[model samples]
Target: MAYKKLSEQVQELSNPQRSDLFVKQFREAVREGKFDATFLTERFTMPKTFSRRGAEGTYQRDTRDMLFDVTPDFEAWFEETNEALAQTRRTGNVKPTAENIAAGLVDFKALAEETRRKMQASYEKGQALGKGRSRTSSGGGASKTRSRKK
Candidate 1:
C-alpha cells in the first residue's frame, strides 16, 4: 500500500466522523503488522515539500514545512515552542530559557481565527479572478479577417 503523508492523514482526522474510520484502519493495520513507525517518524521530523500549479503558470507551495508528531513529548514541545514565540511577540523581548519556553502562553484560538480569515480572503480573491477571466473571454470579439480561398 502507498504511504500517506502526515498532512493528508491530519486532514483525514479533521472531520470527527472520519476519526473513527481512521482509528479502525489503524488498529487493523497494527494487528496485521503493516504499520510503519519509521514512515511516521520521518514525516514528523522532515516532511516532503509539495507544490502545485497556480493561476498564470505560477507554482505555489501547498504544504507547510512544519514538524507534526502525535507523541505526547513532541506535542508538549510543539506547544511550548509556539507559546514561547507568542510570548516574545507580545512582550517585544526575546527571553530564550527553559522556563519561558515551558509556559503555555499562546492563544491558539486567536491564531486559528486569524488563519481562517486569511484563508477566506485568499479564496475570495481566487473566485474574483476566475469570474473576471470568464467575463472577459465571453465578451471578447472574434477575429474579423476571412480565411483565404483554398
Candidate 2:
C-alpha cells in the first residue's frame, strides 16, 4: 500500500468526525504550554543621507503590534465549518448549499473583525499605560564618547 503524503494526511484531520478531536488535542497542548506564540515586530530605518536634505545620520525604529490569542475562536469556527460542510455533503448535495456557505463566511468574518478590534484596543491601552513611564537608553544607538584619565 502506498503511504499518503504529509499534506494528504494533514487534510484528513479536517474530516468532520475528527475535527472535534483535533481541536480538543490542540487546545490541551496549548494549555500545557507546548506551543509558543511569537509577537511580530517591524523595524524601520531613517536614511543617513537624504537626496535633498543631505546627511542627517541613520537610525532604526522598532514598532510592536498587539498580541491576542484567537486560537479558541478559530478552533471553534473550524469545527463548526467542517460540520456544516460534512452535513452538506451527506445530504447528497453536489455543491454546498447557500446557507452552509453563508453561515461559515459570516461566522469567520465576524471572528476576524472581532479579533482585530480587540487587538487594536489592547495595543492602544498598552500605549496609554506606557506613556507614563520614561524610556531609558538601552545602548544600541550610535557610539558614545569616552573620557581619558590623566
TM-score per candidate? 0.30, 0.21
lDDT of 2 by residue, 1-150 (tens): 222221222254545344334434544544676543333363222212223347566433222322324455545754665565456544353334467656664465655688899999999999976864535344355668878899
lDDT of each: 0.47, 0.47
- Per-residue CA lDDT of model 1 for 25-97, tens digit only, reads 4444445644443333332321223345563443222322222235554345334433443344234653445
For candidate 2, the TM-score is: 0.21
Local error of candidate 2 at residue 107 (angstroms): 0.5
Where does candidate 2 have its weakest 10-residue lDDT segment?
Answer: 1-10
- Stretches off by above 4 angstroms in model 1 are 1-90, 93-102, 141-146
Give the TM-score comparing model 1 with the true structure, all chains together. Answer: 0.30
Backbone clash count, each prediction separately = 0, 0
| Model 1 clash number | 0
